[model samples]
Target: MKIRILTRIALLAAASAASFAHAAPAMVTEGILTGGNGMTLYTFDRDAAGSGKSACNDACAKNWPPLKARDDDIAGGDYSIVMRDDGSKQWAYKGKPLYFWVKDQQPGDKTGDGVNNAWHVVKP
Candidate 1:
């Protein structure tokens, strides 16, 4: 009976770990740009480059919050991590950083697009 109980506990622990491994990474998106959950979509400016670093910070980051990446978020294809000055990980696509709009209240809102002559939707 003790052996059976130990086996059941081990199985449960393994199942829990497996579920966490399969979880999707969180991303930001523009409602007008992609059809998926707009919260998981991200965008970059046309002029931004994968080699160059980001310039948005401080108050800028308050209005356009960076789509942060968790430690388990594995990058694929054009997706990468940008190290912020605040020592946080920000998700980047094709080398351009991703951001969410403070004014965007709902999932389908596109209030951030075309703002300040910059900002574009991030595609997967």
Candidate 2:
């Protein structure tokens, strides 16, 4: 009976670990802007003049939720973090803040792009 209990415990632990590992990080593509169950990726305007700061906040943020970073997320290239008013971490790339659209219903959906003539799709 002790052996069976131990086996069950081990299996449960393994399953938990697998679930955590399978969680996807915010990703960016030419189509999908933002999503749940994974990291939603977004792009910023090339002409946006900011030094690693996000201009979207409050009402603007409601439509375009910023892609948050986990504690273990490693910053690379121009990627960095911005502090939101609600004390959340927002991801920034090349000095532009990234955001996800609320209208995108599934993966590969780029419904947020060119919405108000300011947002664009993040390639790759």
Candidate 3:
């Protein structure tokens, strides 16, 4: 019975580990931004900071999800929150909206940068 319980505990631990393996990101490195899962973060050229809005919507947004801002998040310095067309709040750096590319699978992947001459990595 003890061995059975031990095996169950081991299996549960392994499952937890697998689940948390990709539960990272939402982190910023130096001046560069990262996604909730460690993928590269980017911004769209069409997005206008002066307008305080995100232009990437509909099909574009499906591939690039905005970095969400929590209700308790407070804007400080270069970081701020902007309202999207869908009424969702997103994190912004220097007024530019932040997004995650669907194709970026790894932590440092920059595959989405310069795509179609619009997407670019968010720099410091």
Candidate 3: misplaced stretches above 4 Å? 1-31
Alpha carbon lDDT of each predicted model: 0.65, 0.65, 0.80
Q: Report residue 3 deviation for candidate 3 (angstroms).
A: 59
TM-score of each: 0.65, 0.61, 0.73
Clashing residue pairs in all predictions, respectively, total 7, 2, 0
- TM-score quality measure for candidate 1: 0.65
Q: Measure candidate 2: CA RMSD.
A: 7.2
Over 4 Å off, model 2: 1-25, 28-40, 44-50
Please tell me which predicted candidate would have the highest lDDT against the true structure: 3
Q: What TM-score should be assigned to candidate 2?
A: 0.61
The 10 consecutive residues of candidate 2 with the worst lDDT sum are 30-39
Cα shift from native, residue 38, model 2 (Å): 6.2
Candidate 1 lDDT, 1-124, residue by residue in tens: 9999999999999877765663334443432333224543446464266754556778988988887777666666666777777878877767777777888887767677778768765545
